[model samples]
Target: MHVDVKELKGHPGAQRTLSRTVEAPSGLGTVLVGIAEHSDLDLDLRVESVHEGVLLTGTASAEVTGQCGRCLDPIGYPLTVDVMQLYTWTPEANQTDGDDEETREVTAELTLELEPVLRDLLVSALPFQPVCRADCPGLCSQCGFRMEDDPGHAHEQLDPRWAALASLADTLNHDDEDDDASS
Candidate 1:
């Protein structure tokens, strides 16, 4: 995913279109979701010459697949990210403004490594907690039951302070019933 910017270097306003589909690099996602390895990564970009260096702007798309973070169900979707980056001709080109932002540099051979940039953009766009759908009910916390199967599923919960009293009351009721039967 390296682009040769030799022709565009130092030639302000010179631009070229870069359109290609390449295999996605490994580790292009978070633990929850990411682009599949060796999947198709389509890059439709425009490389323009600028005074600072080369400016790249366009879009990159790929198929994103992984399990939902909440329900653990499988999920798949297409992701498209807008790409806009500037490769500075010199490290000092961006230092004049005292900005602390990272700057991409064009190599001495006039090549720009596009993989890192794409990886940063695409990976950052992934959701931290991916879900199969917006309203996924997920699983029940108490018994690990799938809540989607029955929304009203629940267990009778008694206050710990009253638990002893409840058992005593049940015993008393049983004793009363037995006495009535004997009478």
Candidate 2:
């Protein structure tokens, strides 16, 4: 989704409102966990000319599908996030004061390609560790089955630190039984 800055190029403080649905690039959600690529995103944006260059501000919405990070169950959800970005016009005059990475340099032709920005915004809104539900009972460690479906899931676990103690107790019991039998 590239926007031509022609309208706001020569005139300062000019603005334009845009609303369109664009297909996100394939595999855009690969950067985030449990967030599959979305086919289309509806962008409602306002492009305004500023002293530096142009400011893009609006909200975008899309639907993403993937598996829950915890239980690995199929999951799909809608994602909507705000976007406020400034693409500063290049050259020695309008240099941004912030970190070099934080600033966006405009192309010589005055075009703003928004694919990267949209991808970053959507990916950031996604949960780092997704879950099927708020209080999802993840897969049982012992059986790797959905714990919610099997409420009685359990495993007999012995800490390695107590293994030696358990063996000593068993040996003591066996010795006591041998003495009693001899008596």
State how far residue 33 of model 1 sits from its true place (Å): 1.0
What overall lDDT goes with each candidate model? 0.92, 0.80
For 77-105, candidate 2 gives per-residue lDDT tens digits of 88889998888887553453655555475
Off by over 4 Å in 2: 30-38, 91-101, 164-183
What local lDDT score does residue 33 receive in model 1, on the 0 to 100 scale?
94
| Weakest 10 consecutive residues of candidate 2 by summed lDDT | 29-38
Cα TM-score per model = 0.90, 0.82
lDDT of 1: 0.92
Off by over 4 Å in 1: 99-101, 159-161
Per-residue error at 85 for model 1, in Å?
0.7
Residue 116's lDDT within candidate 2 is: 81
Native-referenced Cα lDDT, model 2: 0.80
Highest lDDT against the true fold, candidate: 1
